[model samples]
Target: MTSTHSRARRAGFAAFVGTTIEWYDFYVYATAAALVFGPLFFPSDDPLAETAAAFATFAVAFLVRPLGGIVFGHIGDKLGRRVSLVITLLLMGVATVLVGCLPTYADIGIAAPILLIALRALQGLAVGGEWGGAVLMSVEHAPEKSKTFYGGFTQLGNPAGALLASGVFAIMSRGGETFIIDGGWRIPFIASIVLIGVGLWVRYRVEESPVFASKVEGRKQSMPLAFALRANWLPILLGIGLLPISTGGYYLATTFATAYATGETVALSEQLILDAMTVASFVEFLVTLPIAWLGDRWGRKNIMYIGLVTSVLTFAPFLLVMPGRIEPAVFLLASLVRVAMSATYAPIAAILAQMFRPQARYTSIALAYGVGAAVWAGFSPWFATQLIAWTGSVWSVIAMFTGMAVLAGICTRLAPQHSDEAPVTASFTPRTDTRTNRLP
Candidate 1:
């Protein structure tokens, strides 16, 4: 086998497993927020208010994500993607494990929730860097003809992590009411200890991106964040717009949907919701690769358009079924929504990397995705509940989802697509004079 192909394989595998671990840590918090965080940490007179407060803590991480992006983006751009990624993985793992060990409101009063939020903030910082670097590692190392397919490896983390989180929680939930409330949820959070070792081992094995290594010499920006904003602000804005359905909307389906179903709004069983989500997550894991493969043939934007239209149409139905008392069909809808979501999620790795010139690609992609996630995914559940509290109708939340979908579709149509230019490729040579040298 050729050296390039072998390196790409290692990079792709590292990206896949590393992101799975990072996202697994992230998803555990989301699931806990929706299910048990209120009683364990927030503890309020009004259940709805308690749920809202729990979500508020969940949103805290989003607030910190943009800052994390800038700090690590600079590191990735100036130092290397692999260096930035390893630090992120370690940081996230430590924070998540700490969260599993945190005391509840009953144990330490306000300090309990305070510590929880602090740890979550640290997680936000780690993830903000992890994603942009992971995607770049996979996409940049890929052969041009199969870039989308390889990019899908990084995207694979979302569903795989979600699957692991949901599945683990499903098992924990089986311990019954006494077990779940007592401390069952903590098990999933703590179990992540094992994953960290695996993530660290695999991430360290991967080589640096060939593209970044070749182009990284004198091309780095002194202020990559500032330069990215000045030069490629339009694509960055469009990139943020393009992400609502994939990031925030998916959270809506998983986080908010689970919360709403179990709460007084729909009053569905928690076990049922967790079970359905497990099935849906498994289905999503299965489908992401196929959809990404299709992106290679039909164009990433076109596949995203397909995902947008389907997700928009399904929003109301997906919500409608929540209150309708459907059985396994709820899982079916969840899987279908995720299938549509995969169209957007899987292809976006290649899309975002291609959108930016390699000059400040790390910073540009990180900043754009961080902001987009903060705006969209961060507040989706909180806002959905607020809308319900104000209007006394779930339709308001559905309307918001539809609105974001419409905006993303328009951005997908308006945004520019990237192409590989052979003329530019042969002219540039890899910088190898100093293997350990970095930009000043």
Candidate 2:
């Protein structure tokens, strides 16, 4: 027991570190898209058009994430979670570093944006495979009673990565807009190679998930993807339904908000918005584990209910406060929304992990999240920008945010939970299903 607990801790820490690095690479791209990618790669006469174009390239990664999930999910379910993760980290790191090295529009004209889109697609693929394996590494290794808490460790990476990305950009912006626009944005992308090295070292040292080792090792499926689709299709859809606040709403709050706050409408300084985001990420990081711990006692679904509702309530106020240009209010509201969202985000690792049995859990979870992220996170910033562009009001965005929150809440209620160790049952019921068998 003592050795198992120690191993679990090690695995959890490794999951946290690996995901933090991956998400840092991801968030740095998001931060750059909001800040410099527009003028640097996709020059435009209209500032909004430039931002929209940058966000379109940002969306490209997301569109390809589902394919990444399919490819890497196969490796994770067949080869090993550790093997898949190591490859993904290396792929993501190389792409991000190359992004930093690429020439801009001034240097290469149309090819610059094209190259940017290609790298972003690579990032999407890596990340599509990343979340499921990381979550399983932490949650599957966890003691049964503490799965949500250990899973929270994986959740910590999001805010930690966001904090690192936003904090670095915030510091870079202190050198003034010209400094960041001229060259500073590339530093974060290039610096990610160092984090990739550290993540690789940690991931290599950690043991493979015990669930995979004990239950899934010898009895490999002929085709994990086909098996998952045939058996876990409902859960996959439910998983996608449950992730709106975590995926789409999250980007709307952070990436889109950053650009919106600094846009012509709000007219706030870039530094101010970045600083607000930095503080909010820090606050979310502090609260995520505690909230995940609460999910154990309070019921993961109930905790998510609170988060989904709060997201609906707080998001409108967040937008309202931004236009006021009250610095303190902006910081407070942004942090508040993030805190609400954390409840929806943290327990998700365990929730999603438990949705499918260990047979093809990797592929199932990856597909769900990859598709959700592609649809939600990928287009959200651009969608929100277009919403404001068309309606000339933040209310349009608020309606979209509210809709996402509600959808998540409904799906949370509908999604079934399964224990990987539970005995296989012979049934295919949707809501009351508790089967954990490898399908024949």
- Residue pairs with colliding backbones in model 1 are none
Estimated TM-score per prediction?
0.94, 0.96
Task: Look at candidate 2 and tell me the lDDT of residue 345.
Answer: 97
For all candidates in order, the CA lDDT equals 0.85, 0.90
TM-score winner: 2
How do the residues 194-245 of candidate 2 rate in per-residue lDDT, one tens digit apiece? 9999999999999899988887877768799998999999999999999988
Backbone N/Cα/C clashes per model: 0, 0
lDDT of 1 by residue, 1-440 (tens): 37766777788889999999999999999999988899889998889988899998999888888888899999999999999999999999999999999999999999999999999999999998899999999988887766777889999999999999999888888888767778888887888989999999998888888767777556667888888898889999998998889889999988998998998868988889899999999998999989988877777777888988898777678888988879877888888888888888988888888777777789989988899999999999999989999999888999899899999888777665454332334333223212111111
Please give the lDDT score for candidate 2.
0.90
Runs in model 2 lying further than 4 Å from the true structure? 424-440
Q: State the local distance difference test value for candidate 1.
A: 0.85
